[model samples]
Target: MSESTPFRAAAAGRPVAISIRNVSQRFGDAGSPNEVVAVDDMSLDVRRGEFVCLLGPSGCGKSTLLNIVGGLFPATDGVVMVGDKPVKGPLPRDISFVFQESTLFPWYTIRENFDVAFKFQNVAKSEWASRTKQALEAVNMGAFIDHYPNQLSVGMRQRVNLARGIALGTDIILMDEPFAALDEQTRMVLGEDLSELLAKTGKTIVFVTHSLAEAVFLSDRIFVMTARPGRIKSIIEVDEPHPRSPDFMLTPKFSELRNQAYALLRDEVRQAIALAREAEAAHA
Candidate 1:
């Protein structure tokens, strides 16, 4: 493992891009019967340009944590600092999101969608075309610029979605299973594309996913969380560099990391299932 990669050591020396300190999220009033704790006290630092994955059971608040970091909403406790700015609300210029579902407006052409994002980010009109072209070309979607979202297949639209996120030119991207709906083969291909993007752009990424292989393949470090009232169970380092080849997955290190992640989550998954069953019974 030590000879396989130097990313882990290199990551430690990078400046922190995101600082999450004692963060917790709770839904409903404190002490109420309906109160739900989505995240418990959690803290971590994501280094500049590092790709980190939040992986755990279904109800483990991975998405909640991502949203908190992105400032989609406030966390019930603690603080999140992106660079020197404390995240009180959405920092559109510094952050972007790519979710599982395609967020493209069906009526807009691919080019129009990028235009809208750039406009919202207040990027100069002069840079919009160049940014759009570069981003789309990076994802192999430049030819589809004039096509509407509905005109493209799921995978194509996702590529466009990814391209749009990149064209926003943010320093950080928070992704919530952006490739979850795609077929396995398409997902793998997109994963590789994402790796290349990471290497080329050097953007910090915080991704939430349940797939062990995806976590192992794409992350510099994987944060495996416990079930609801989610907390970090373990942080597993992949120790690999970006623009990774699929051939890396054929190696023993990949298998070792994947198996380790699974072992951590297996018990948490069962616990989440049991909690769901209990909730159903109580409602019944």
Candidate 2:
């Protein structure tokens, strides 16, 4: 339909920006001995400016889903659409990704890394300096504009990685455990910055994370998934506005939402563990 229509008329008047319909991602051939199913028959809709988190146990293909939606690869079945167009391959200008590890080139200065991404996105040279500067300022890393990635601490490097993603000026960002390597305190601070960035830019974000508190703190809605061949088990809404404070975590409501997410994922975590064990035993 038009931009005026919400997916299934469910997402208020916000208009669906990403539509994932019955998408399944697999590797190897079905009925083959080594076949693997990463995601199975899952569907989701992300509205414009929405922050949605995919939370699940190990091997649940949270990252795989993010990859499919970002068009790093197409799904094995079903389709993922950005606006009205089906995602066939990388949409560099429309989507950007920040992964678990810092992706900055070690040899390049921070400014050079932004230039590289700008080239890939076909961003104009005139916009490069302004975009890079604005993104670094947002993440409080403007002082390190000339520094190389190797010179920064892990947390600092990740901040620049996130800034590069922002500088690309995509409407959507897919982050797969981008803060997974950091200490709890650092992750919290970065999460706060991300929330503020979301409020400021109105960009759509699909974040995959394993931390319950992080998911509860950062997400507008958390989509919890089952074990391998991942499928959505629950969708929990934070029901709060953007630029949320750390004080929000101190409230009973935050605790309640976190507990609910844990309850939903606990079984899935166990199931994932059991499946891994069975697979190992069969091989043995």
Candidate 3:
């Protein structure tokens, strides 16, 4: 038999950038009727400069977990630590988030959006122009610097959104299905660009995604979550190096990893769908 590869070695002695210890998130107080446990006793560690993906069916609370890690919302139980410090609120200086929706100001030009984001991060005014130019160039959006968000295509807008996040110069970047709205072709292109960007920057990244291929292609490890009251079901390692090529997507190994993830997730997705239908029926 071939020797099995060690999973921990993928991280190769990198320090943990984000740590979630038995974290649980419930929307309402204990014994409350409207309570919803969005996450349940989930523990995860993301190593510095690693790309990790949170993959799951809908309602599995992947975004909720990312939000908690980003301190957009606090967990009801347990704690989150970023680079050895407990996260109690938004850590703008250490973390950046790219949501599924474009949060860019529609009236603002692409460069203006980046300017505003840096302002929010309290970056020095003198550094804004150079930093914005550099980040946009990194994402290949330097040409559209003056275009308003509305004028850009969905793919272009997302590129700008990504640029804005990178311009913040945070050590950790948390993405909540940032490519969900893009078409398959656009997603693939953006994913490739993102993979290259990660390789170049060595920034720690945690991305949330529903696409199995996307997860397999972009992540060093995939964290699969169970349905509502979400918990980590399994962690699958992608043994490939980053700056992954389109040819990798066509390889048998890529499909095998993607299929493994799908197999683990198929039943959970059905259950989530059934639960949603039941809830809808009750409401009706």
Candidate 4:
């Protein structure tokens, strides 16, 4: 697609939320044997209010692509545009990140954690309370507002972590394996809740996950990546509408799509492992 192509044509009336044009990321200087080209010449367009998932094997640079989109790291080549503006640095007011590890302050209460995040975003003190409350309620974490991070379960902590991201009130949210640490049951529940929340809020979300099922269940489209140096192998459209139900999980369509993604990734994953082993052998 051309640079002028809309990120999400369906949501064109809304806005072009994120545009990644031929972006690449390399971790070392030229001529270095140890240099790793993490991401290679990938382009994607994410529209406002759309949910896109980056699905790839470990070391396939899914996170690298997300970091470039979030402006957490600069791309070695190509450009990232958020809402038509080039992303040069961390756009705190426009982007919020939910990492794999809970970023909540263990020392502070949940309410306090939100307060500090809002403070960092320079949201007015007067608006903090209401925004914090509203966000917590949206994630169903409102009742635990006064609880400290250590007192919460892994699932609960993630709820608070998600709330903190939402409380930032940013247009785009980038999540990197945010539910990977939770048990399968917890992850399922959280995934359902997240789907519902996305449907209601219409927030543009770009999530990175290894779960084939999660990608099929939650994303409008899933970007299946190749092994490192990572490239876009294929993009799978889920076709299922959001606010998806557990019943959807048991259907043939879901299983069929999941299998398709696995088939596309199996060889790449094996190749990635073989490459790692070769590198290790050379080092030894």
TM-scores, all candidates, are 0.96, 0.95, 0.95, 0.94
Q: How does each model score on lDDT?
A: 0.90, 0.90, 0.87, 0.87
Q: After superposition, how far is residue 280 of candidate 4 from its true place, in Å?
A: 1.6
The weakest ten consecutive residues by lDDT in model 4 span: 1-10
Angstrom error at residue 71, model 3: 0.7
- Candidate with the larger TM-score of 3 and 4: 3
Task: Tell me the deviation in Å of residue 17 in model 1.
Answer: 0.4
Q: What is the lDDT for 233 in model 2?
A: 82
Clashing pairs for model 3 are none
lDDT of 3: 0.87
How well is each residue in 220-282 modelled by candidate 4, as lDDT tens digits? 878889999998888777776678899999999999999999999999999899989988998
> Of the candidates numbered 1 and 3, which has the greater lDDT value?
1
lDDT of 4: 0.87
Candidate 1, lDDT over the whole model: 0.90
Q: By how many angstroms RMSD does model 2 differ from the true structure?
A: 3.0
lDDT of 3 by residue, 170-278 (tens): 9899999999999999899889988898888888999999999899999988888999889988888887877889999999999999999999999999989997898
List candidate 3 stretches off by more than 4 Å: 1-9
Q: What's the true lDDT of residue 43 in model 1?
A: 90
**Candidate 1 Cα outliers beyond 4 Å, as residue runs:** 1-7
Q: How many residue pairs in model 4 have overlapping backbones?
A: 0
TM-score result, candidate 3: 0.95
Q: Which candidate is the best by TM-score?
A: 1
Which candidate would rank higher by lDDT, 1 or 4? Answer: 1
